[model samples]
Target chain A: MKEPGLEQPGIAVEVAVPVRRTPLDEISRVKMLACQAALGAVIALAWQAVSGRLVDDYFISNPLAIGRRLVAWIGDGTIFVHLWATLYATIVGFVIGSLAGVVLGVWLGVSRFAARLTNPYLLALNALPKVALAPLFVLWFGIGIESKIALAAVLVTFLVFLNTFAGVREVDRDLIDCARLMKASRAQVLSKIVIPSAASWVFAGLKTAVPYALIGVVLGEMIAANRGLGYLVQFSGAQFDTAGVFAVLAVIAVVAMLLNWLVEIWQERMERWRIVSR
Target chain B: MIELKNVSKRFRKGDEVVEAVGGIELGIRRREIVAVIGPSGCGKSTLLNMIAGLYPPSGGRVIYNGKVIDDVNTSVAYMTQKDNLLPWRTVRDNVALPLEIAGLRRAEREERADRVLEHVGLTGFEKRYSSELSGGMRKRACLARMLLQGAESLLLDEPFAALDAQLKLVMHGLLLRLASEASQTVVLVTHDLMEAVTLADRVVVCTHRPAMIALEQAIDLPRPRDVINVRFTNRFRELYDMIWDCLRLEYHEELI
Candidate 1:
């Protein structure tokens, strides 16, 4: 019955105290917010000065006018259709590419024969410029969402595959020997030893691939698309509405940032037991 | 009970074949602690690996309890020189790995793991990761995991060789006590002569590369031994001199 962290011999109940933030921490946060707001204001004023009016007849529009246009577009369900088209393409491509990469990467890492046979092919594919294949994808899959998804999947697969394969292959050999001596079955060794050991690497691959998925979707739309944010940019540029183009670019930037933030949250949540912090 | 009869191991390097262990014959009785000592590249570790079923002998059989061990088995636990705890797992979960892999229920595994943790002086550190622990604590965790596996025999490959003198003595005491309680048959490989003398019931001295057993000596020290007391005894010096005689001759021959 020793008291915790004391020289007594009695049972003690410990209470966790919430951490108190200092004035310096509060000031730092406020400064960050102020800087962001200032930057946004400067951009808005610059757009107003360049456009010459709140609403233009044919040329570039003002920031306020573009905001109103966005509101109207959202109300008419146009934004929803375009957003859904891009999002659907990204999700489908990410799932298929990531799954294939993880499976093949692990297979290659564990088997010498597989690694030897596929090494040259993997290197040759990785060396090729992924963007150059967009036209081929369109020709093979048409101007539909399938072509866009296929392009995105190809871009993301290599990044994830290399990270996961290296992660598994670089595992501590001593741990493998220990598991083997304990009579672990091949399946158990893979699930319990190999997968958990390579989790950080897999997560690293996923983080890198998330950005690739967004880039793939945008690139696909840039080549040939009737909807999505990239299409919105094209439409605005064609009309000489620079403000509208900037606004659409801003939306894509925000979407990409939001996706990255979501990935960070997921990684942290899944790796609570891991040694390295996300 | 373990026996190695006419065992030989060879490895191919480039175009040449090099013998690692050559024509070795040895037997260890049940619950006996035997220490194998030799110079570097003497293939002591290779012999222990063959006994632990990590490798197969090229010429002869490794019989454990009258059964030839050719592949990995759960009956023996091998402690490597490097601590191999999973970084993701806490001390408790790491210790319970064998039980979990053997399909024991969670509660039962936890209970068994906790008991072993207490034995290793890690009762309050169940949630600590391997990264958070010091070197000695990590080594203790490795020992606790081996104990939780509940193997009848242990093959340790210079487990305490990396520790400083003080920590090595403490760990040696803990290991000897645990082995006594578990009634385990232990085969230890080490280059340290003092370590071989302290914990072993019998010592096997091996020659240089393409190694073979040179001499075997029995130690009849009392239990719950104190190193200070043992060192002061004449029997300690006698065993030390006997081991040195063989080691000195082997060392000179290799140089020549």
Candidate 2:
């Protein structure tokens, strides 16, 4: 209750400043957070409504009931065991695949003879549907984590290999000439100049390959695994436990987001100079 | 300290064999600065390259310090028109590169690199990358690297052509000062007539295409040359006129 000419000392000014938000930054941040919360709430509400309206509990359980079930699973240590199994397979497969891919890619890119000789073989292998070969992998290595890991590694390798090969090939010729003029020895030129020049491309490839690495692990598990999140999804779906299947999917989405976030952080650290200069 | 005896270079383009330089004989004495001036495509760079041991002549031998030159000679430093600085290395590291490649200890190479950097007025730029530098600064960095090589002779292939007029003059002065102090023999190839007159004790003019020595004029002008003082001098104009007269004929022939 203040006159128009004489405003309240604290309340009016405080409200006015916030309403103005002239910097645009604070306003944008607030708006973004609001949007995120709104979207999350809408999704949750929609899921709750759909589950509530379902005629059969076996087909679609309530979102609240699924949340409770997930909590119970976590408490009983089943979630931890499943997550560990997936993580172990993924890490081992990713490391082996990425290392082999980079080595082969670099060698092929540097030597024309090697590239020419191996191009047809590589293309044939890359073109073949890897998922269709899961049965063969299971047959060859037996139906253990080993077969799944091997399958995952094979799936991840081609993506990394192609990216790295293109990256190495795309290194600037001018930089190479400069190194030659400096009288740099073959090893020095390769390690010091060529590798660093191709670094940005290699990192770009790695970023694109991160999601593929996770997908590879999941695909391998789905084909045949007794303990992974993918196995849980398959088992739940067969039993018509729709809530349990959704819970497994939700865990996978979270893991994927976390892995992608870690990749972005690594990329930022590697390309700090490029970002700062830009 | 360089002797090119009847050096000729030819390039085969499709079915045509074009001679770039024809039987050019030149002797560059120890600590002498020689500038080769000619019209475009007159094979001035080809001659310099032969002297630097970067290219082999179709006929004739290039002798430096009484040794027949074959591949890139360790006793010679050649600076191309392009700066050619490695973007990855800091300025100090780039300057010390030749020494490192020659198997010198890191400590000794760093000391030599520091001395050359100071000599080239780049004392505070040791840690700066080549990508962060301006055109003139990059040229200076290249010059510093050449200085660090401790070569007996320097071959400059239009090293200052990329610079503006003002920067070019400043660089010309810097080169003159450096050449005097180092007492290193230098053979420079350029199309700029005035640059040749200003920096060189002797200038060699060549004819166009299948180039041959048209004239060799000795500049008797006094040392520690002031560009301002020399620019107005009658001797400078006379030398420029002499080189231009020879180059004009070659230019007309090239047009035909």
Q: State the lDDT of candidate 1 residue by residue for A1-278, as single tens digits.
A: 43456554564556565678876666777798998899999987887786665555346667787788778777897877877888889878888888888888889999989999988999999999887899999999988898889988998888889988999998887788788777788888888789888888988998999878888988898889888877778888887777678667767788788888888898887787763422
Interface RMSD of each: 2.2, 3.4
DockQ by candidate, in order:
0.35, 0.19
Clashing pairs in 2: none
lDDT score, candidate 1, position B138 = 83
Estimated TM-score for each candidate? 0.81, 0.78
lDDT of the candidates, in the order given:
0.84, 0.80
Minimum summed lDDT over a 10-residue window in model 2 chain B is located at B80-89
Give, for candidate 1 chain B, the lowest lDDT window spanning 10 residues.
Answer: B223-232
Best by TM-score: 1
